[model samples]
Target: MPIIYRIAASIFLLLTTIPFVNGQIFEHPKQQLINADSLRAEYDKAPYFGLYKDNYFIFGTSLNHKPSKENTNVKFQVSIQQKLTKSTLPGGTYLYLYYTQKVFWNVLEESLPMKDLNFNPGIGIAKPLFHKGRYIGKFSFQIEHESNGRDSIQSRSWNKISFGGNILLENNWLIHAKFWIPIVDGENNKDLLKYKGIFQIGTQFMTNDNRWKFGLLLVKRKDWKPNFNIIGEIKYRFSRKADWSIFLQYYNGYGEDLLNYKMFKSQLRAGIVITPPMFSDY
Candidate 1:
């Protein structure tokens, strides 16, 4: 095995095992654990920021955590994300922004995209976001723009804009609903433009620390398109400087079946998130 791989494996093992050995395990009262869902309730009642439900604004970087057959650690990116609520209510409108630097192995072989900047920004809104401490409803509109730092005169740019929303029902059972609409002819005046939609339902569960989220995503899209997809993710707080998440998405329609492009694709994505220390609630 390569030396780098060996080192990473050792560190991962140590981080996972050492915590248990040195940390004190909490013994909860029988009544609390036996109840329907006292975990969130206890934390929510805390005086300070306990059960925070605000949207997240994530800014950080990502690398080729998962590689295609021809691309080995072929890409690197720096991205910014913002998730804001339209209101302080349990259910409200919201927005998220994501920007990245993407380098293609076939296009830019040795160097990473961090050196040559590529940007993608999206804006959207979700309504009645999280409601009744259990269910949340949302509708969002999204637009994405991608461009390389190179001169506009040299090469054409890439951009995609989509509008859609999802309605979520949160409870111990975890069943929820989702829908998305892709608006074509919405970008630069290119014909052959079309719109797409999707709907899905699934369930999710919470873990001990109350810091992790995991769920199954079953989805369906327009016919003549790939519909089935499996989704899983773990979001955790690494420290004050960094927050991390690992996500796995497997589906049939990674590409545009309409254009006969990328009809099926599978990818794994992992990213770190950073916040302004001045604003963070240390």
Candidate 2:
């Protein structure tokens, strides 16, 4: 059993067999994972998933290969993002689930006893365009899966797809991008494919009233060779649910044999998010 509880009981029986096999179109009984007036009407109608200011709250923690480390990688996460509709199912939809664990102790030279645990489920499609109500667009897809800990070692079951967007200037800035694809074909380990990627760029900011939020991410991978990655983030929201975030990252790795990946290592993350509030018709 123990293999992270059989991969978390097979992702809890595939999330209870996906609503009995899509019986009611994936059922959405007024979905409310967190309701602050339905997340302020999906953030007045889509503020990048309304800043997740509605639902999705589990927990998070991270500390990965940092400050001259030799394997003491620690990561723990539990996530949920549910909102069957508010718009998007047709072009911009959302349903995300996450479960992660990467624990390795100072045994980083790969003996044959290496360990890994990663489970991910994602569905996100976006096409929002609201100027007055504020919520930019152009996010296409993100499908993920990674189950590694050895089950025959075939790249440990893998898949990923991505396409991205975001553009909102003026009222406090916003810009985002993404591009990733790895439809199956594993084990080339170019420093984990330079954090595996097609490409990514990012930016987002909002302050005070919205409490606070800041972001930046830059990722690159043009088929190995000195690929790059960079990450920076900050977020804060006292009440109105809850939020706390911090992240710093850098990567440029490769060289399992001359492919040579290196950027030392840097990662320090702290996270917490809770939502539920904002419903008024007075």
- Specify the highest-TM-score model's number: 1
Which candidate has the highest lDDT of all? 2
> Taking the tens digit of each residue's C-alpha lDDT, what string does model 2 give over 10-37?
5434333232211212111122222334
Residue 227 local lDDT, model 1: 49
Tell me the tens digit of each residue's lDDT in model 1 across 194-251.
2223455665554434344555666564466564555454455543223333333222
Which stretches of model 2 miss by more than 4 angstroms? Answer: 1-126, 131-135, 142-159, 167-172, 177-191, 194-201, 204-217, 220-282
Backbone clash count, each prediction separately: 6, 10
